[model samples]
Target: MSAFHVKVKWGKEMYPDIELDTGEPPMVFKAQLFALTGVQPHRQKIMLRGATIKDETWDGIKMKDGVTILMMGSKEEDVPVEPTEKTSFIEDMTEAERNTMLQLPVGIKNLGNTCYLNAVIQCLKTVPELHSAIKEYKPKQPESSSLLTLAVDSASLLTLAIQDCYKTMNSGKTAVPLILVNLFRTTFPKFAEQGEQGKFLQQDASECWTELMRLLMQEITAKDPEKTAQNFRTSLIDQFFSGEFSCEWKCVESEEEEVTKSTDNFQQLLCHISQDVKYLHTGLVARIQEQITKKSAILDRDAVYTKKSKISRLPAYLTVEMVRFFYKEKEAVNAKILKDVKFPIVLDIFELCTEELQKRLLPNREKYKDMEEREIEEERALKRGKPGDVIKKPKTRSMPFSFEDDLGSNNSGFYQLQAVLTHQGRSSSSGHYVSWIRLKGKEWLKCDDDEVTSVTEEEILKLSGGGDWHCAYILLYGPRILEVVEEGEETEVETKIGEET
Candidate 1:
């Protein structure tokens, strides 16, 4: 019976009133020491008096209440410190070593039910322009003058927190966005809602994405002010994520009423899921034209109207949200639809645009086709050429996909899928969220909380909602850039306004 309470001293810290049982192996005490300090049990060296403690048993050791024991060890370092010696280069390493050195991007740790926030942050980080904006954001002192001023200050602080988290992740360490999570809870009180057990409840990922964009819209502005002078959009969110719809409203019941026309701005496109919708394009098309009951001026009463909307302006980065959750009266919850919907890697919205916008998009569409054909021909010629033979490079041509006057407006209605935020559960309120981001050509990264793995293009296509597996909730699409190569210069990729090179 050698059970007694003792104090352990490690480095400058001391653990007081630690109960130890000698009946159990000495390894248990080392494990307790490892828990107190970050050092592993194997690395821990415990000393009682002048004798070293054995891991097998406490044979010759005699301990009393309040006895002080010395422990020494250091926790393993996650990020390597700068070496005092010569730096290693990738060219000096073998092929296998080089492959090992190339690591995937780090992920964010989930704080309670913050997977929705983590997933949205990862997907948004893939946008080069957004990342640059966050890096450049300067925080100001808190202003308590008015509600609007307070909101702006909060948004600025949130942006800085996100920048700090990104820096930590870039250092090859998994980031815990503790400050950002707190700021988000403060800014949007809805996220602070707790469960009956006093724990934070899971939320919808799409809702989190929308709220974050709203906060960013308040703080992030365009990098170059000169380019945004002619356009109505001055904020980065407006320039990169906003789109305009040309809408026409016609009274369905009153045939004599005149059709009214209007324009509406949208941050993201909603893809409404229904029994008739099997493809993403079809769902979006169905959403564009719908019947609504509203007050009519000619009828002077509530009447059914047919509203038709067409894309008048397209942004550089297109956000499409899948409307999978619907409110059920019986359950009083946002239930999810598990129907499978197909989405394409390359999306063409030529048919979904206004007639005038469609006309303007034809020239750039033709240029993209020509570039693809030329690239195929060059590959064939390279395969046929002999060693040391030089194939003449094609002359470079200007391919501007963005409109000149409207800084971030896309001239061509074409987009490539960039990132996807997915949810896995039966309902929106209780589910796991994960982010899948495209890395270079045909390669993808699946970020599940603090675990990140490499995935292929074929694997990404299977995320289109089917069952209990991951379902695509939100999809982010970036403009498909056309690359042109010059004889004397390297190939250049075109980008939208405010985009980093």
Candidate 2:
């Protein structure tokens, strides 16, 4: 590795032998990798059509007007480059690499771009037969210009195409034994920029795209399709998501900040259609469908998942906000024996909490066996207590807010403070139950880190609007809950805003 190098500041300043394999050299490597997108000029080849020099000889390292010059490959070929904009490169998955990185496993993403790229490359590298078959084909196009963007679009294309092929394979149809980019090149050449310029005076390659697809399926994909797809998929994941690479979550909120906000657009599930994208029809369709679901707004909205709205499927933009909502309710509901309760258990402890709620309402026999004992218990508690004054706050069903009270009670390990506040979240239809107890900053901080997901900083700000929402009612037998109930005699339960806490 005796390659000397010079690190020249592109815009501001300049420098003159730089280490090749290290330092600024890495930038060169990275730039080249980035350029690998559309310009698929073989790994070791160079194809610079138009340049200012009489020849391609630019000495040592030179920086002229925001351009960095480096001797590339066999001859010192100077290439102009720039760091890809962060926004352009790392698309904020709310919106929006190359080989040397692959050393591990990937997940079953509907469309993991990295997986697609790795899989397609592996599929191609492992099976040379696939290449020979593809070499016989070329892209056909009504117009040209599309050819120019091939390199830039390769990543998206490869992933999308592989996904397509996977979908087709899933449909019980045979798929390519190797990567299908060639098939994409052959079948959708118009899209791939391979335009029908046959090796020997192209004679309109193949008019029927379908026929090309048929030939591809018959010859390549159909060969041990499943293994090919699986192997390709496995190899891909193993290569990309290796080690040391992980995401860290820091609450966009700072300790000093009073409020936080986050905007959660659901576009993460989108798979941009790429010109080079090639995959089995079955897999492709399945992926697109799955993606449609993953980013679906209906799902993200945490709306009372109606079967009808879900029929069309939700888009990615709205899906981000649907964090925890899915599994949270199930976990909460499963926390206790929710059904087939002893009505007697209900009646035994009924008056201890609130007598009004236990009244004529359905006992949910399936939910409770008896209710009288609980009613009597409540009657006794009320008897010990004075005639409670019920504050009448007319129920406002329109707003997404509610206030409820629960009385005092106790047990062994920790007294049975049983007031569980159940209220519908602004975005949810079903009521969510949170212990009305007020949590400290530490707890909120923990929630900030764990409970929150997908919602963006911008969105959170709007919802929270600088308030800690740091309050609720959680006492098992606080004076609040007992205020509405009377003696063993029945009484009315009313809600009032001015009522004292």
Candidate 3:
């Protein structure tokens, strides 16, 4: 049998030059690991890209030479042969105390002012597509960055660190992303260099989000020989987050028919502060209809330009940055707009679209409305002690002009709130960032550095910013897909794509 070398890491130690035959069962590889780490094959759980490799042949897993795989689970722990019987009493604890004792929260460990990174990571975790992308990543070549001072390559370290964290989270374990933090700080000298009293300072959450997203995009394309590493500017961010605006420019002496038509792209939807604007939908709609005038290129006189943007292609996850910070010339600081602009759990952007795009969206909107009405009727019937008929939602089909081939395509203009990154201080430079993520309906988790606690839907509504407390700075909304059900299937069925990856 032909054997190839691979690297295996168990805890802090890496065992290199481990050879295994490609045709052999995974148990054969585990047997060798057993000799090195004193861990039995049954107890060992081998993982690749945040997924557990099954106890099958290497061929089944597409294992290649020099592949780095994560090995979890420990050697057998010593347990007592005899058990000590103890008596329990009702007075042992109060109901609240017992519930508190039963709770075990999963969270990250804070490394200085790394709460911003933590908050962003927790928020991004809510995206199932991103999770799938990270799991499907396979390194094509060895990282060869000599600038890295760490024992391992900077890129590989960051990738493995994040993949390991994802794997741990999937296994329901809490861990600190220590390796990623170290490499991130090292790669960006500004992040590591900037601080007060010789300590790392708090960083902006959006900046962190952008940097991490860039790295992830690069990793996604690294395995393909045809494609090179891509930055966020050229990757899915542009494909999905981008919106197109049609600009009609007319000269001062020009007629209506002689106007020039151009297109502009925007990555974020700005929520302009206005007196009557209370909801997110209203602010976005207002921004899309504004007109302005500027000096024409050929004609040195002023020209009227009317610009209106409509999303031509919708990404699975839409990121909306609340434009709350503005530079103050007199004070030499960034001022915050603490307007309580209330956002919705379900946001509809159909009205903001062009006439043509609106026509394309109406079909899906109608289907979604019908699904909602049926669900509501079912709920009412259940409340009235009447058996309701099981209805199957229509399966999603492909669209020609969609954003990308990736998952998370928003067929309709409807979106549901997935995550929110909030800031607590007055200035952008100095503020605490926390992540409020929607786990499911009416259930949210508040991730504040090393602490994570449950919050109500009411608490999320209050994050719109009216006080000195944490306010929603960045909102991430994902497509609200119609729930897929089957006839005679009374139980709710979760239709998850790319679960294997």
- Model 3: per-residue Cα lDDT over 271-308, one tens digit each: 87677878888888888656778776666677766655
Global local distance difference test of model 3: 0.66
Residues 1-501, model 1: lDDT tens digits? 567888888889876667777865675565445434547555678898978998767889998888999987788645678779787799996533343467568788898999999999999999888988887666543353332211124566567668767866776668877667876886788988998999999988888888989888878877565664244466888888888899999999998998999999888989998899899999999888899999988878999999999988888889998999999999999999999998999988888899999998897787788778876876676677655555654557656657776667778898999999999999999979999999887789898888787899999999997889999999999888876555576654443322221
Candidate 2, residues 140-240: lDDT per residue as tens digits? 22154533322223333333344434433333333332233343343444423323553211111112222332344333322232332122222212111
Candidate that would win on TM-score: 1
The number of the candidate with the highest lDDT is 1
Give, for candidate 1, the lowest lDDT window spanning 10 residues: 144-153
Model with the higher lDDT, candidate 2 or 3: 3
Candidate 2's displacement at residue 367, Å, is 50
Displacement of residue 252 (Cα, Å) in model 1 is: 1.2
Report every candidate's CA lDDT: 0.80, 0.24, 0.66
Candidate 2 residues lying further than 4 Å off, grouped into runs, are 1-501
